[model samples]
Target: MSSLALHVADKRPEDPADLTGFYAGLLAVLNDAALNHHGWTGSVVADLGEIGGYVYMKIRPGEGDEPFATIEDLRAFRKRQAEEARRTEEASKQARLI
Candidate 1:
């Protein structure tokens, strides 16, 4: 896919950690939408380029393969995943013990 750059102008974060946190949080949103089949999507595209190199986000609420999501969506997906993980873990333990 062709990449596009974003120009944030004066809204850039000074601390590098801020960028890292943003990227991670955004990733979580996208991952949740992708794995949960929830009615949403989250996306972020970033590039380091002169003039326009920047980060962009697209939040969609539909059954589409777009990287875009909301905080509430991510939380719900994580909770469901955690519950499923526990169930799987318990099942494995039971099988091993049998």
Candidate 2:
């Protein structure tokens, strides 16, 4: 089944360097993970404030068919009809030559 995991962390940044460091550390952790495969994708959203900040990281997994938008939904629907049409045209050309 498809699932979505969102990690929301409320933070107060003392300086710009602190926010930069926080993002860097998160990226490092993501890069260190070796088993991130099979439709695993992540994104980070940061809310900035003068005295503080908050960041939310969301990870989504692709699977199944449901009411929501899955990764597979976009990938499967994208260009599939065009590809099929191209293949059909090629087949028709080959039939004409034969």
Candidate 3:
């Protein structure tokens, strides 16, 4: 099966102990969304803050072809993210107004 991987990185050297738990939280969210059914494999790591470590999810396509997000999917995702950001900003503004 072809595989695709995602990476999350931070440049700060905070607490390494928090990395695994952070990634586990992410995994829980992803798994809750049935991401595993999408052929995703995930992992997390932390090394000296230089690497910043990351949580990686791999997607495998059928027939051993690499999995890729279509342009439509990318666009949809971007739109959703933007919407969420806007909602968050609006909420923050309302909270500040209170």
TM-score per prediction, in order, is 0.38, 0.31, 0.36
Instruction: Estimate every model's Cα lDDT from 0 to 1.
Output: 0.48, 0.43, 0.43
Roughly what TM-score does model 3 have, to 2 decimal places?
A: 0.36
- How accurate locally is residue 19 in candidate 3, as Cα lDDT from 0 to 100? 57
**Best first by TM-score, ranked:** 1, 3, 2
- Over 1-98, each residue of candidate 2 has an lDDT whose tens digit, in order, gives 42344333446465876765665454444323312432344332212122245644333332343223333433344357468779999999999999
Which of candidates 1 and 2 reaches a greater lDDT? 1
Give a tens-digit lDDT track for model 3, residues 1-98: 42343333343326888755654454354433334544443322211122334333322222334233333333454467678889999999999999
Is candidate 1 or 3 superior in lDDT? 1
Model 3's lDDT to the true fold? 0.43
Clash pairs of candidate 1?
6-54, 41-68, 41-69, 42-67, 42-68, 42-69, 43-67, 43-68
1 or 3: which has the higher TM-score?
Answer: 1
- Between prediction 2 and prediction 3, the one with superior TM-score is 3
The superposed Cα distance between candidate 2 and the true structure at residue 90, in angstroms, equals 48
Q: Pick the candidate with the highest lDDT.
A: 1
Q: With candidate 1 superimposed using the best TM-score fit, by how many Å does residue 44's alpha carbon deviate from the native?
A: 14
Q: Stretches of candidate 1 above 4 Å error?
A: 1-61, 64-68
